[model samples]
Target: MAAPAAAISAPGVLADLLPASTRARAVARDAVLVLGGAAAVGASAQVAITVPQISPVPFVLTTFTVLLLGAAYGPLRAGLTLALYLVAGMAGVPWFTEGASGFGFPSFGYIIGFLVAGVAVGWLAGRGGDRTVLKTAGLMVLGNVIMYAFGTPYLAYATGVGAAQAVEWGITPYLIGDAIKLVFAALLLPGAWWAVNKFRSQD
Candidate 1:
């Protein structure tokens, strides 16, 4: 029988950086990645700054982390990382924003969006979208759009507000922050690539 696939064989920037010579080594690397990546995302979710004006949707670093993870890990592992985070949070890990955890929370939609964004960003990164600043930023913008696609409608439904109100509360208020995040996330992948190349040259 053919060997089983590695946990993180899906192509992306980080996968290229961490290639393994053997299937066994690849599997080991993937194991560490699955667990460590999930934990890192969970921890990032905890860096929440509540905008009372944007209650139920605090300004957290989760989105930034999600985008970065996806660009680094590829779609499958990035999606799995977010899924594991959701499961742990739902199971009362208190890792969600402001130490909150549950399925019924209004902000839960964004968490779901994280999974979608992860896949989208990872796919784009795998396609070399992450190699350049502009392309990477564009991919991050797409990821952000995917996030709001889930988040906006859910915000409307959960709060019993109209679509306009949902946009007002959940979308508009965060546009600047999201843009800032996209720029940073966009820069990260290319920067990592530069760092990797630099380190390789030193060897």
Candidate 2:
């Protein structure tokens, strides 16, 4: 009898890892979060600054979601979900700027930067900055920097430009937009967390 009871309790013991409410809300949260992220990638895809001077690169809002998703989801989940965005875009889902499709291009580094940005934001969020708007901006700034870390190299390789020139053209041009995104994501992420926590606190 005791042996059977132990067997029955094993699943429950494993289930206790994430806590009751947190685990229970996972299904709804995952659907809302991931799908919301997908939609965001699509929306951000539209926010672009096109200059014929630099047709290959345009400023966009995807970086904003990169930080916000990481902050909201935590590092691993954020990374995985961002992977989904890239994979989808690569699969010709039109999640990139100007509804671009296909992959294996020069700008793929920017996509990689999105992944790094998510991880950076998620790492900061895991450290308890989820409810803090100011810190969220700070963290996003750092994340945007890291985004450039990955993107500059790819841009250089793709455009046949020297590393220094790539940084000047690809990374430098985007800093102002990324800074704006930091402000936006800071406000956006903490605001959402506050609402969710406030509702939960009431309950």
lDDT tens readout by residue for model 2, 35-138: 77767876887887767575367777777767776776777667777888888888888878888867656667888888878877787677766567787778
In model 1, which regions exceed 4 Å deviation?
A: 1-11, 198-203
The model with the greatest TM-score is: 1
RMSD of 2: 7.3
Judge candidate 1 at residue 92 and give its lDDT.
88
Task: Summarize candidate 1's per-residue lDDT along 33-87 as a digit string, tens digits.
Answer: 8789888888887888767666557788888888988989888878778888888
lDDT of each: 0.82, 0.71
- The residue-level lDDT of candidate 1 at 59 comes to 83
How well does candidate 2 score on lDDT at residue 127? 72
lDDT for 26 (candidate 1)? 84
TM-score of 1: 0.87
Best model per lDDT: 1
